[model samples]
Target: MSRQNQGNCDHQKLISETDTPSLHEDANTDSGDWFADMFADFEPQNTTDGSYRGTMAKIKATELHYQAVFEQKLVEANTNLKRERIRVTIKQTGNSLQLRATLPLKPGDNSVGKQKKQYDLSLGIPANLEGLKTAIEESYELGKLIARHTFQWNEKYLGIKSREKQEIKTIGELLDTFEEKYYQTRQKTITSQNTFANYLSVIKRNFPLTHLATKENIEAIINSVQGNKKNELIAVTSVLIKTFNLGFQLDVKRDHVTPAYREIPDDEKIISAFHMFEKFALSRKNTNISDEIDTWEMWRWVYGMLATFGLRPRELFVEPDINWWMSTQNIDHTWKVNKNTKTGYREVIPFVPEWIELFDLRNSKPLNILERKVEKIASVQNINWMRRDISRWFRKVGIQFQPYDLRHACAIRAHLQGIPIKAAADNLGHTVDEHTKTYQRWFGIENRKKAFGEVISQRSLIELQKNEILALRMENETLRLEVEKLKLLENV
Candidate 1:
């Protein structure tokens, strides 16, 4: 039996050695109990480099909270803003880190394309998102300029209590608002409308100027406009003068208007009275009449009136009030011109016989109703009424010349006459120096003759003085003889 058992064992050994190795039904997996004990959530499956994969992770469930705060400082010296975006994605480029922001263009805001070459500036953006970044940067940049203007505007409107809204992102808008608030309401002269409108035009069309709202920029812009080859240099130069005087004080600019590029056009100085009478007063009937007897008689009358005696149109209109014929007093006597007006200055103007005749015809006295209403001339705001009346008169007379031209024409005529410079200045309410400079060009040959006549008159005064001295001596001698005779008669 031992030998048989030995043989079976030998046979088994030979089978194990020769045949393919056979395994048990299941291998023992419990040998990794130590690993399982050490790490219950993870286990190595293979004998190779040991690493395990888990279906669910025990990683930290950290609540990733992000808070982004944006702080912006305005270009204005006194402005700032704080904004927050909870979920904005912060991006870091090779050069800088930034956050993409979506900004909307406000209504009426100027477009990027509309900006002038000088106005357009660099806002760095990556090639990947250029448009969006540019828009964001530009909004803030433009906002800065607006903020600066707004602050300035507020300071200007300091004393006046107002419910006025603060707007005006662009320089054009700001100036428009200021003009409406300040100039249109307060400006005294309707004739100044066109002058102010010209300023408005410059503010709008000049793009480079719009960029320059500050004082320095304004001067630069004005200089730039003058510099431009396309525009009239005089127009721009005038704008600079007016803006310096009237524009909102941006601290960089002056409060009053300066005659920086002052050029007084000879025509601009004194309006041609003849032209104005023909344009403003005459009926449009071309009768080929002589200058002495024009088809337009009323204008001729106006010319004669101005040339004969210096009278302002308003003064002519005021005759019924004071009843010049009844009172035998001019406006200077009726009302203290200087006292009534803000500035105390008198109206030293005089009227001719022709003007008096016209006044007599127009006079209506309902206890002087015409005079009562005309104590103060009605306001001619924007010159709508004045323009309408002027247009009608011009159309009738068949040309274009404003009523102011009459004043200038009268000034020229007086200058042509041997009227003293001071008298001419006083009649027209101008400084003597101003009148001299303006009308020197218009003094004709007749004027020179009148001037020379004055020299002859001066010489005549000297000769008359000499004759008076001789007469006084003769009278003294005669008086002495009479006294001696009276004494002798008394003795006899």
Candidate 2:
């Protein structure tokens, strides 16, 4: 029941459609809301369910192709320091149609951990079947994830054949292999590994295994992602698909085994992914990563930079500007845009005067706060990792966070500050129509926040009474003195 519906039956309650934010610096709309509102309940299909019946038919035909080979099976147990034997009994559950490893811990641990255990996943596997390709994708996917996570933590898998046994696999198989490998070694920033991860996930969830590229699968996967992911996906997929079109090139590369695999995902189906990020910043706190940073200040910085500014970790080093906005603002209490914004294209965000002052102070600091957290940056392949790490820290302090939640929060903040559609566009360097059209979803929360600014947000902010205010005043005075000294020197 957003102000939009006013009282319109909660506007797709089951789907929990996201709300809008304020205008951009306006930066942009609030949420990305990319996916179509596909809120159909998971009604178990009887024979009469037409869509299920058809999907089942297709699934049966596809499963007929694979000959699932269960290489080995065993249960492994470990005794904790408490001398408690955490024995996990594994079983190949569900009909042979799918192999689901029933863990002793059912409904699994959905939290941050030392070493992430693997979940036995059903990759669109049918309920019951026979000679139809022995559907063990679930087991296979689980094994791969386990091996991958184990390798990452440098943890040992004493049980049966780890994934080191397999060498040649299809594109989908290759990606799952890499995701585990990349996660294990803690290599997060690499583009290819992440790209492959997205590709495989989409394929696993939506597309069938008959082949790498199909019209429907491509469209479906495309429809799966929206916004920045859509753009990035498009950029990567387009390049590869075009290469895929080069038949001889693709063949030669296939023969030689090079970096020329172009599994083209559909463009039209690529939804605006920004909406997917709505909410969750203050959800699912990650405790492990919290142990890494000294203060929540760093998390706030990360949130402001990414969620508020849309600056990637790599883009943190924007060139110096006239005011030299290293981080915050200056003497006259105004924010400064760094020359890094030299290409000078910002949309949906504006260099507010107060913000300028904030950055002016930040600018005075050394150019490399990054030195403190290189390890963290080095492992940032997926933004989700950052979210988890931050969430972990906040959770330890009793806060919730979801990955990329900051970005969403920032977008919402920008819009709420009453940033115009065009300024918001300039702030983000995106288009304006988007700002106007999504006026509701991306703007709702922001609108609410703006509508009731200090009452909620400034509550804790008001905690900056006594010496905290003194510190700010002193800082501002110091800048003023420095400016005076500079003036005298110029006059001399």
Model 1: lDDT of residue 347: 47
Clash count, candidate 2: 83
TM-score for each of the candidates:
0.37, 0.32
Q: What does the lDDT read for residue 470 in candidate 1?
A: 96
lDDT per residue as tens, model 1, 86-190: 112224343222333232333345768642211222233221222223334333433343333321323212322222322223465456554543331122233
Off by over 4 Å in 2: 1-197, 200-242, 246-295, 304-324, 327-369, 375-384, 391-396, 400-418, 437-439, 445-492
Q: Flag regions of model 1 displaced more than 4 Å.
A: 1-171, 180-198, 201-346, 351-426, 439-441, 461-492
TM-score of 1: 0.37
Task: State how far residue 110 of model 2 sits from its true place (Å).
Answer: 74
